[model samples]
Target chain A: MPGWYYDKKELRHSPSAQDGIDYKTEMRYRKEGARLIINTGSKMDLGYNTMATGVVYYHRFYMFHSFKQFPRYVTACCCLFLAGKVEETPKKCKDIIKTAKSLLTDQKFTTFGEDPKEEVMTLERILLQTIKFDLQVEHPYQYLLKYAKCLKGDKQKLQKMVQMAWTFVNDSLCTTLALQWEPEIIAVALMYLAGKLSKFEVVDWMGRNTKHCRWWDMFVEDVTMDLLEDICHQVLDLYSQSDAPIHPDSPPLHSNAKQQMPSLRPSNGQEKTLSPDRPPSVNAKGPPLSDVPQFPYQTFTGAPPPAAAYASVFPSSMAGPPGGPPPHLSGPPPHIAAPPPAVFSYVNHPPPFSTVVPPGAPPYFPANAPPPGQPPQHRPYYPPQ
Target chain B: MSFEKSHTYEALNRIGRGAYGTVYKAKDKKTGNDVALKRVCVPLSEDGIPMNTLREISLLRQLNTHDHPNIVRLLDVCHGQQMERELIMYLVFEHVEQDLSTYIERHSKGFSGVQIRSLSREILNGVDFLHSNRIVHRDLKPQNLLVTHDGHIKLADFGLAKTYDFEMKLTSVVVTLWYRAPEVLLGLTYATPVDIWSIGCIIVELYSLKPLFCGESDGDQLSKIFRVLGKPPESEWPEENISIKWNSFNVNSQISIDRICPNICETAYDLIMSMLTFNPKRRITALEALNHRFFLEEPINT
Candidate 1:
C-alpha cells in the first residue's frame, strides 16, 4: 500500500494558525549553497539534497508537532536522519549523534575535512527523537525537476528560471507560509516567483493561450506584483541588479521584456526610454517612481524624483507639443495620485507580498495579519511582468 | 459517516484511514451518484505536482475501462484544487454501503453454508472476471470486498492490482499477511492463486463470522493454515516451483489447514481446500471454484 499523508487543501490563512517561521533562514540555506553552485552548473549535491530533505522533514514534523513544544534543531536533525534513511546509505547511530552534537555545538559542525560518515552517526539519534521515530513522510523531489521540463522552445531560459525558482523555495522557507502550503504549490510559487523576478522568455507560456491555465492574468498580478518581486527584494535585494539581465547581449537570457511578451514586444525597435506614448516623465531614471534630482541618475538608488525634475527627462513629452499633458509629473497626474500611506514602509522597500490583492480575490496575504514566520506556504504572487 | 452528499459531496467525515490512502464518501454534483472517493496521495518531495498527477490521469485513462458490475468503477479524477491540496486525484466508486467485514460484523450470528454459497459465488465471480482480464487484485481481503445493501459481493481496491504482463516479474508479499497465500509468506513469486488464498480467508470469515488465520505473525499464520490442511508437501511445492525459495517453509513442509473452523460440509471443505492449497499451480481458478459442488448444490435464498 502507498504510504503517504495527503492533504490537498491550501493551509494558508486557516482560521487557527501557529507563529509563522522566518523566511530568512531559508535564504541563508540557499545563499550559502547558491553562492557555490550558481556558476557551477547546478551540480547534483547530496549535501543540499539532504539539507533540503531535513528542512522539509522538519517543516512537516512541525505540522503535527507544535513548534512550541519541540526544539527546531531537533526537528531539523530528525528530517536529516529520515532523509539519510530514504537515501539508503545511512550512517551509524553514533555518527548521527556526533553530527547532532557538532550541528549544535559552539564550534559547530563544518562539512570540510571531517569524516562525514562518522559525523552523521552522532547526529542520527537526536534526529530520530525529533521525528518521534516515524519516517514515512519522505516525498520525491521530481516535482521541481519535472516542472523545469518545458513545453516550448528555447529551453536554456527555462533552466535558468528553475535555479531562480529554487532560490525562491529556499527563501520562501523563511516565510511563515511554508507551514501552510503543500510542497507542490511551494515549488510552483517559487517558479512563479523566479519567473516574475527574471521576466524570462517563458512569460508568454503563462498567458491566455497557455493550456490549463485560464486564470493567467490574475495569477500574474497576484504572483508578480505581490510575492515574486517582494521575494526577489527579500532574497537577492536585486532591485539594483535588474538592468543587467535586460541587456539583449546576455546568452540564454533575453534582456528585452519583449522577449517575454511577444504580444507587446515593440516591432519598430524604438527604445522604451524614448517612446513618447510612455508615462509622463517617460525617461525618468532611477527608481522609476521617484522624483528627486539631487544626484545624477547613475548615483540615485531609485531616489524618488520630484514632479519638476521628471519633466526634464523627456523634452518632447514635456513640451506638451501635440495635445498631450507633459508625460512628466507636473502636478498630480490624473493617474497615480500623491504618495499615500506606506503599507509597511521601507524606503526602497516593496510591501510584503502577502498583501497583494488580485482584482477579484481577497488579499493573498492579509496586510493587517501579524507576520507568522515560515510554515510552508509563503504566499501566492502571480507575476504578469 | 456524515454526508451532505447530494449537494457538494462535502467530505465531512472520514470513515476509513490507511497508509495507502484515505477513503471518503462523496456525491457527484450533476448525477448525484453517492460515490466513495478513495484518494491515493503519493509523496513527491520538493518537486511540482504535475508529473504524478499526469501519470495517474494517463494510467486511469486506460484502466478506467474496468466498469464491470463486480468491479469498483473509477467515476472521476479531481485535480483543480480548492483551498487545500488541489493536486489530489479523486477516484469515484459507487456507494457499496458496507464491505464484507462490516457485513459480517452486523451479521455476527454467521451465515449457513447455503447462504454462504451464494455470497462466495458472487465473490468468486468478481475474482473470475478480474483474473480473466489479467488483473490481479493483489490486496484482496474482506475490507476490499464490498457487500452492498442488497447483499451483492463486489471486489474493490485496484490500487495494488497489477497486470500479469509476461515481461514483468513482481513480488508476491502484497496482500495482508493474515490472508496471504503460503507462497507469498515465503516470498516466492506466485500468480492469482495468492488472491485465492485471501478469498479462502474471506470465505471462512463469511461462514464463521470471524477471521480465518488472523495471526499477527507470518509464522503463526502459516502454522494456523498447516494445523488445518497439513504442511505443504515437498513433492508438490518445489522451491523452484515459484520464483523465490523460503527454505523454512519449503519442500515437504506438510503444513495443514484444518483448525480454521470445524463441521464444514464436504463440498465447502473441498472448495476451501482447493483454494488454500500450498501448490499454487494445483489451486483451482475462480471459474472452477464456482463450479464446485458447494455452490452448485446449495442455492442461497436468505
Candidate 2:
C-alpha cells in the first residue's frame, strides 16, 4: 500500500500525457465535477466535510486519470459516493446516480450506459487505485474551531471571524488550494483572510514573540506570512470568480466560479439551471452501454489486451505508467516529465539536504544531512542565516 | 493497470465472512508467509466504494503505522477482477489461527487467570491505542478479536471504527448487541467508553466460557443486561439523555460477579465492575484498566 504522508519531496505524479489530459483541462473538469457533487450532495443531505472530502477525491483522482476518458459528471458522482462512505454518512448508489443525473441537466454529461451505476463502480475501482487506499483527507474545517478559540480578539468579532473563515475554507475547496497547500496552512490563511475582512488586527493577535507564537506557528512550524497570504489569495480568487464578494486587491475571479457552487457561497435564491452551452461532445459517438462490452471487460482482466482495445477503454494518453500508479501524484512522475518547477521551498519537492549544504561545508558535516542513499531529503535544515 | 503481478497471494482456504466481504487464509507467494486476504466485494453501483472499506483502510493505516503487536496489521491492499463485472478488493492482513470466540470454544475446559489477564491486557492495549488516536472501535466483540497460534491476540475487523467526534450524532446502534453498552442500548450519545463496556462484557464472557449476554434481539439483549446488572436507575440516565422511552422493569438484585464467575479473583471482579458501570463517565478507561489491580496481581511473565 502506498504511504499517505508526503513532505514536499517524494510526492508522486505521472505526466498529463500519461493520463491523456492536460493539467488545466483536468483541473477544469475537477472543478465542474466538484460543483456537480455540491449540486447533488445538497439533495442527499451530506455535511460540508463530505462535500470537501468529495472535492478532494475529485482533485486527487485527476492527478492520475484524464477527464476526457472518464466522464467528469460520472466520476464526480463516484467521488461523492465514495466520500459519503468515507465520511460515514453513506447513501445508496441508485439515489446518488438519480440525483446526479437530475442535476446534470446538460446533455453533455455522458450516461455511460442505460444505468450509470456500473460505470460509476468501474470508475470507483480506478478512483481507489489513484488514491492508493490512502483515503484519509484532513480538511481545514476540522481545525477552524480550535483556531477560532485561540484568537485573542473581541468575542463578537471572533465569532464573526470564525464564520467568515469557515465560509472561506469551504470556498477554498472550490479552488486547487486544498491540493496545493496543507490543511493547516489553508486554515491559517482563512483566519487571516477573515480578520482582514473584519478589520481585526490578526497578524499579531496571538502576540509577536516567538515563545507566545501565533496559532498558525503552533500548528505549521515553517509557515510564513507570504505563504498564508498566497493561500488567502487563492481562496479569495474563488470568491471573486463566483458572485460572492472579493478582497479589494485580488483580480476578478474566473467565470467558472459561478453561482452553481453551493459549497462556495450563500444560496443565490435562483432556480437551479444547468448551463446548455456545455455540449455532450465527448461521448456523442459511442453507444450508451450500461455494462462494459465483452471485449472491454476482457481488457480489464489481468491479461494485457492489445494496445488498441485497451486504448478504447482507457485512451493511450490516459494509460497509467508502465509500472503501477506511483505512490503520491503530488508532483510529476520522475520518468516522464521534469518535476513541476519548484515554487516555494516547500511547494513541490524540497531540495536534498546535500544540495542545500553551502559551498564550503564539510562533505559529512551537517548533522541532519542525508547519508547519500536519500536523493530527496524533505527535511532540509537551512543553517542559521 | 494490473495490480495482480505486484500482489500475488495464493488462497489456502476460505475463512469466515467479513463485515462486507469474503475472507480467505492465503499465502503471500512473494514472501511465502501466510496472510488473511479479505476479498471486499465492492458492489457495482452508484454509491461508489463502501465507506466501511475506506474507514477500515484509513484507520488501519494510521493505527499500524508503528506496528503495534496488539492491533492487526494491514499488510497489503490489492484489486482483482471478480466475476465479469464486479470488482474484488483484497485487504491483506496478517493471518491469525483463530478468533477469541473460537479460542475460548476450543479451550472450553478453562484458561488460567494469568492467561485471561494477558488477553485482557492485550485487548486493552489495542483499545488504548485506538482511543488515544481519537478512534472508536465501535464493534469490539469476540468475533472481531483475532488470536494467533502462540496465544498472541490482536484486534481486527475495523469496518466500524471511526475518528471520534463529540457533537456529531452518529448512529446509536453500532456494536453487536451482545457487547453493546447500557448507554448505547438506551440510544444515548456514545464515545470511547462504549468500547470499554464491550471489553467488560468480553472479560466476563471469557471467564465464564460463554457469552455474558446472549440475547436474540435488541430488547432481549437489554433485558438480559438489566437482569445481570439490575434495572439501571433513572436518575443517572435522565429522560432527556436518551431517545428510548424508559421501560418500567424490575429486578430483585444485581447478580454478583461471584455468582456469575466464582473462579475469577476479587481484583478481576472489581475491574470488570468498574468497566461495566452504567455511567459512561464512571466506566474505567482502557488506560486505567491496564493499571488495575487485576493486571498487577498476576505479573504477565507468569
Candidate 3:
C-alpha cells in the first residue's frame, strides 16, 4: 500500500501555499470542501464511507495540486463521484452535480463553470492522476468499532464512547490528520479522547497488563502519550473553533497572532461566503469591502500597498483559468480566452524553502520523495525559489 | 499529470482483444523493458469512469503491491489520448511469451504427469493467494493463465475479478460457461469456490487436451457437469436455485474419474474430484488442494 502520511512541516508548506494561498485560507477551503462533499453525498443518499473517502481524496488531491488551480467544490464533487465508484456505491456524476448545484449558492455554483458535467468529468481524470490511482483508503470508523468491541465496559457507555469517536473521525476529515497518521492510530487517539469526555474508563480490556500498560498499547504498540495527545488536540481544535457562532456579516477574528502571521485575507467576496456554518445564507450580504479594516501584512506579496494587494489577489472573472477550459478541451471557451495571468504567476515563483522552514529543521523532501518507479509526475511539485 | 502514453510506451504489435479492451505488445522507453499494454476505452458519459474499470484498477493495483510470483505484474497505469467522447486508459503489464492455452497447444503430446502436477500446483498457489487476500478471479481459464518461457504460471485477466468476502451475489454472467461452477449456473450466490471449480475444469483439460464440460448454454453447462459428477442430491440442491428443478437432469450415476482421465494417478483423480464437488460448501478450496496427496506423491521438477 502507498504511504499517504506527511509530517507537520510538510503540511505547513502545502501545494496550496505554494500557489500563493495562505495556510489558514487553505484550511478554510478544505473545511468547506469537506462539508460540501458530506452534504452533497447525504443529499444523494451515499453512505458515510463513500463521503469520507471523498473527503480523504479531496485532502490528498490538494497536497499535490493547488486549491487555487482547481476550484474546491468541483474537485469535491469529482472526489465524491470517484469515491462512490471506489466504495462500490456508484452514483452518476450528473446526480452529484445536480445535488451540488442545489446545495451551493448562485455565486458559488458559478465556480463549476458553464458545463458542470464536463468540468467535473475532466477533473475526474486529474483527480485520479493526483492521487496516484491509490483508490483503496482505510478509515478510522472500522478500527473504532473493532477496538470498542474488545474493551470491557458498561454496554451503554461503550456504545456512547464509540458513537462519539465515530463523530470525531468524521470531523477529523476536515483536518490534515488523515494525511499525517494512519487510520489505526487515529482510531486509538479518538477513542481515548471519547473515553475522557464520556467519563468511561477501560479497567479491563481482556488482555494481560504489562508494567505501565496503556489501553492503546494493546491495540497499537509504542503509541506514545505525545502522539495520542497531538491527534486528540487536532480533532479538539476543530470543536474549539466551531464553538463560536460565525455570523455572515461578522469578520473572522484572527485573535491569535500565529494564525494572522501566515494567512492571507480572503481574496474575494466569494471565498468569504465559504464559511461552513452559514451555507444556506451563502449569498447573504456581508459588510462592504470598503468598510472592512485592512491589515498590511495580510497581503501575500509582502509590504505591497493595500490597493495593489487587493488588485493582484482578485481575479477579473471567477470563471477564468481556475475554472476555465479543462486540459482535454480542444479549444478554450470564449469566456476563458482572456484570463488574468498575473493571478497564477506566484505558482511558479514560491518563496524560498528556508523562509518557511525554521533553522535546524530536519530535511523533509529528500527523505519523503515518492518511492522510485512511481511516475515522475507523482512527485509533489515543490516550486522553484 | 501522467506522461504522454505514446512517449512512454512504443507499441510493438497488437497482442489480442480482451473482454474490456485491446492488448498490445509494447516497449517501455524509460526502462527499456517489454510490456503488454491493455488499452481500455472509457466512454465519456455522464456516469464518468465505469465502476468495473475502477474496481479492476484498484484491486489489481493493491494485489500487485504484494509482487506475488504466480500473479501478473501491473507495472504502471497511464491515461491515453482523450477523444471527443471517450477516454482511453493504458494498463502496462510485464509481457509473458504465451498463455497456458498456447503452452498446452505447443506441447502436442499433452503435459507429462509431472508437468501437469507442477502446473496444477502453481495454478493452485495463485488461486490460494487471491482467495487469502479476499479476491476472487471470476474469470479463470487456460487463456487467462500466462505461462512464462520457464514454465511458470501467472494468473491474468482480472476484468471480472472482485474482492469477495462473505456472501457476495455478484453478476451471474461471469467466467466462460464451460469453466463456470454449478452454483453460478443455478443462479445462486457464490464466493471463492467458483474459482476452484474453474480450476477443476482446467485440470481436466490438461489431460483431455480440450474443455472438460463444453456447453453452449447455462443449462447445457449444468447438464454436462451433472453428467460427470452425477446430479447433486436433492438435499444438496440450493434453495436459491428455484428456476432449476431437481428432476430436470436425467443423470442417474456419476462417471468414474479413471474413465474420464485414464492416465492420471489415484491421488490426482482424488484431488480433481474433490474440486469438482457439486456443492460449493463441499468443494475443496485452493489452499486445501495445494496440500493434497496429488502434489506430495511426486517430486516436481524445478
Candidate 4:
C-alpha cells in the first residue's frame, strides 16, 4: 500500500491520540516550513519558477520520507537550493543558507547548523537520491502566459487577469495541486478562476471565444471537466483556509534569538544539539503559546490581512467575487482518487502504444466516425441471412 | 520503499563502459527479465549526483511516461553501496540484442538500401517524439541507436538531451565531432536542427557503410562538408554575422546521387540532401522528414 493510504487513515485520528504529537500536526509544521522557505526565496529575488519547483520538490520528497526523519525547514531550504541550480538560475549556496537561517531564527526555531554548509549539502545529496535524480519539473507559470496570449480580449484587462492567474498558480503551489494534476490542467483551471474573478471571458487555444464551448474544451484534449474541478477545489480549499493562523507550534517572529537554529555539526567530536530553546513542557502534546514572544509579522499582526496583500506573495483567499464558493468548489475531488505515485507504477509496465490517444484527439470523438483516413477498426463481413 | 538493488537484481557479466559508469547485463529477480543496468558511481561529496546522470534520469523518466515505441524504456532505478563507501546508482533499461553500429559491423558491407530506409524512418519517428516534447537529443548517432532481435530500432543514450527554451543559452560543444552540425562547429548556438544534421550523417553512413564526413578536427569537419556540398551561401549564416574562412577549394556541385551511391533511390537521396541543408531553417524537420517520399514508399515498410 502507498504512504498516502496511511496518511488518510492518520487524518481521522482524534487530537487525543496516544502520542507527543500526531501526524496532522507534523504535516502542518512541514507545510508551513516549506511556505516560509518559498517566501524567503521570493524575497531573495528567485524566479517564481524556481520557488514553485522547490515547493513541488519538497512535497514529492516528503511522500517517500516523513518529517521525523529529516528536519522540515532544513529539507525545505535544501530543496530550494537544489531547485535553483536545476532551473539554471543558480544561487550562491551561502545566500540560500543565510536566508533560510534568518527566516527560521526570526521564527525562533532551531536545527543543526554547526556546519550549515555540510548539513545542507548532505541533505541535498539525500534529496537527489530520494527523487532518484529526476530534477526537471514543469510549472504552470509559462502556460498561463501562453494561454493569456491565445485568448482574444481587452489587452489591459487580459494582462491584469493573467497577472491574477499567475498569483493563483503561486498560491496553488502551497497545496498538493502540483503533485496531483498536470501543469496544463492547473494552468487552465487557474485561468478559469482568474477569468471568473476578473469578469473576462477565457478563450480557447484557437483564440475563439469560450462562451459556447465547454470550458474544458478550451484546454488540451486530455483535460477533463472533472480534472479541472478537482484542481479548482484543491485551490479553493487553500483559499478557504487562508485566514487560519500558522501552525500552532510555529514561534512568533518577534523572538530575540537571532541565532536560534541549532548547530548540528560536531564540534571537538562532542554531541550535536537536537533543537534550540528547549521548553519546560517538552513532552507536552503541544507547545504552549506563552513562551512565544508577540510579533508584528503581517501574518500575526491581528488585522485581517488584506486579501490582496496576503495573496500578493501567497494569496490564501480569492475574495470580492459576486457570491459564495464558486459552483465548481462544492463537489468532491475528481474520481481520479489518489494522486498517482510520484514515480509512476507504470515505470515497470508501460502502457502500450495502441492505447495512446494521439496528441490532439478530441475528448469525445463521434461514435460512428472512423479514425481519419483509416478503415473502421471492426472486421467487416456480409450478414448471414 | 527504497528500491534495494541487491535484493531485486543480481548482476551478470559487464558488457560496456562509458564516462559515467559501466553497463552490465542483469536479471530482474522477480520477473526474471533481462535488463541492461548502467552502474554509475556517484560520490557522496559536495558535488552530489553528477548533472549528466540527473539529466539522463529525468529525461528518460519523462519520455518513459508516454512510452514511445521507438525510444528505449527505462525499466527501473536502484542503488547499492560499493567499495570505498561510494554509491553506485544503477539505471535499469530494457535489454536489446545490439546497437546500430554493431548491426552494421555484423553485416560487413552495410545495410541494404531498403534496410536503410526502414531504419531511417524509425530514427525519424523517435526524433519526432523527442522534438514534440520540447526536448533535443543533442547526441544522436548510430552507436546510440539500439536494434532488437526482430529488427525494431529504439533510440537510446540521452546523456546530452535537454529541454530547450528559446531564450536559453547552451554550450555549442555537443554531439560527436564527425556528426556535429555546421552551426555547432562554427560555435553558434544551435537547437533541434543540429540533431537533423547528425541524422543526415547517420543516414549516409547507413547507406554507404562509412561516415560521410570523417574530419579529424573541427576545422577539418567543415572543410569536408564544404568539399562535398560546396560553400553555404552567405544568406545561410545570417544568425552568424561573420563569414566562415574556408580552405581554398573548388565547388563540386557535380557530385550527384549516382556518384555518391548509385543504388540509393531518388527519394532517399532527396531526403538526405534536405537534412544536410546548410541553412538551419531550411533543414528538414523530423516530422517533415518522416513524410518525405522516401518513407512513403512501399520498400520501407516491407
- Find the 10 residues in a row with the least total lDDT in model 1 chain A: A292-301
lDDT, candidate 3, B87-128, per-residue tens: 667778999999999998998788788889989999999999
TM-score of each: 0.41, 0.55, 0.66, 0.63
Q: Give per-residue CA lDDT, model 2, range A230-273, as digits (tens).
A: 56555544322322221132222233322212212213433232
Q: What is the TM-score of chain A in candidate 4?
A: 0.58
Q: Give residue A332's lDDT in candidate 2 (0 to 100).
A: 39
Model 2, A41: alpha-carbon shift in Å? 3.7
Local error of candidate 2 at residue A281 (angstroms): 49
Ten residues in sequence with the least summed lDDT for candidate 1 chain B: B162-171
Q: Residue B225's C-alpha lDDT in candidate 4? A: 86
Which 10-residue span in candidate 3 chain B carries the lowest summed lDDT?
B162-171
lDDT over C-alpha atoms for residue A3 of model 3? 62
- Against the unseen true structure, what C-alpha lDDT does each candidate score? 0.46, 0.62, 0.69, 0.60
Going through the candidates in order, their DockQ values are 0.03, 0.43, 0.41, 0.22
**In the order shown, what is each candidate's alpha-carbon RMSD?**
18.9, 19.2, 16.7, 18.9
Error of 4 at B293 (Å): 3.9
Give the candidate order by descending TM-score: 3, 4, 2, 1
Candidate 3 lDDT, A1-385, residue by residue in tens: 2368898898989989998999878887887788788778867767777888999999999998898889999999999999999999988888998998887788889999999998999898888867767898888877876677678766545654564466567768888889999899999988876665453557677664775366667778788755875686676445324212222222233333222111111223222211112221211232433322233122211212122232332222211222332222324344543233222111121110101122355322222123433332211211111
Put down candidate 1 lDDT per residue, B1-302, tens digits, no spaces. 32321234556456665435667876667666677877544222222222323333334434546566677666554432321222334555676788888888888776876768878888888888878866667778888788877888878775343222111232232335788888777667778888888888888777667777766677767776776666655566564545433345422445343444564676787888788778888888988998888877745434
CAPRI quality of model 2: acceptable
